[model samples]
Target: MPPETARLPLAHALALGALHGPAELVPVSSSAHVELIPRLLGWPSAALPADVRKAFAVALHAGTLAGLLVLVPLPSPGFAVVATAPAAAAGLLLEDPIERRLGGVRATAAGLVAGSALLVAADARGATGRGAAEAGPADALWLGAAQALALWPGLSRLGLTVAAARLRGFDRGAAFALGRQAGLPVVAGATGLKAWRLARRGVDPGLRAPFAAGAGAALAATLAAAPLRRVTSVWPPAAERVALAAVALAGLRRSPR
Candidate 1:
């Protein structure tokens, strides 16, 4: 089948979308899950064109962003702009190249392991007391840099941002808050940009229903998982990333390619 014509079954779309919510809310890479899950399941969507997959991923992100907007308080405009600028610039300049070169399972597995290690180190060394409100220009810049680094597949935006915040000495609650707030603008901007491109190109008629189903599922799942925002430790998610990376590596080994 032509990659563009490959269908994403509604069941697959809904499953991925539902998984997207909590995966996005936590430190695990939601993009990794979206990509790897389909592959692992031997779903036809795994063979879709990269552009089509990306568009669907953007749709999921849009839903997640909508939920985040409701759950997370609006950040200060200055903080939002500064904290999001690095990633915005990076995405514009390097997103395609990075995706082309580093979007493979091997690279993603390496990124997962590396990012998990960083999270562990940061959490261990970080001291408690500072709140998200205490973030300054330097904090924004550092957080923005972390977000930029996350453009590499499996280097999760949420994980990196939280690690950056923790390294900056924020408490668990504060780090989580800072991570979520710092990420909101970036996600919104990326989703909007991609959605615009998808709109201009026009979605395939066959994809529209799946797209809508996925987006709705993501939005509902995110809202339902709002309570997970209170999670204090990053260790569990870090461990999960490592385990997932192992699974991906094992799968890669088993593949004839």
Candidate 2:
């Protein structure tokens, strides 16, 4: 922070954390919210550097990982290992290129629309019999493959993971648990990589404040989003599409020639 600002903006960090944690826990295109919400509030542009923004996102995710661990019980160690393999592999291969080239507002909007459709369809058509304990490596792989969709950004990792699990006949709780569990390894890996990159770029001392705020907010929100028993319908996420469209339109107007 500049000397003129004096105190660190804990409120902004908390607001971002509150926003990121729930959006992430519910898996509704948190990638969209992390960027869109900040840009919308002007929290991430001039006031915060790009690197700090990335750090804050990573920290918020780390916090969500903690909440998920507590809120959703993990599968067996072997079960989780095998299940996380596909997405971990995918992340190692594709993370950089996607971040470098595919991350843009339009791509995000398209992905959110497509992902929302998948979430609702999976919920509506799924048979909801098996529970999370019944989920095996094969099921993990299925959800892991779905997790790859998050590489595109604006596609909810939670959405695709839950959708795939639900479609695989897992019950709602099981689907949600497995979906979130499956994401842990991948998210952890991605966050670690981001932190490493930030370190190489010479980590800023200011990163700590945002990290603390985001982590705290994410921890609270993740716990809250769980056990809420959301009944999925088509219309709710439609509003998300509208929001994304508006964001895109705004981005177009703001883009420089």
Residue 205 CA displacement from its true place in model 2, Å: 1.8
Which residue window of length 10 is worst by lDDT in model 2? 1-10
State TM-scores per candidate: 0.97, 0.83
Tens-digit lDDT string for candidate 1 (1-257): 25455489999999999999878789999999888878877888888888889889988998888888999887899999999999999999998899889999999988898999998899999888998889999999999999999999998998999999999999989998999999999999999999999888888888889998999999999999999999968889999999988988888789733
Residue pairs with backbone overlap in model 2: none
Task: List runs of model 2 lying over 4 Å from the truth.
Answer: 1-8, 44-49, 199-201, 224-226, 229-238, 254-257
The runs of at least 3 residues in candidate 1 whose Cα sits more than 4 Å from the true structure, single-residue gaps closed, are: 1-4
Could you tell me the lDDT of residue 7 within candidate 2? Answer: 31
- Per TM-score, the best of the predicted structures is 1
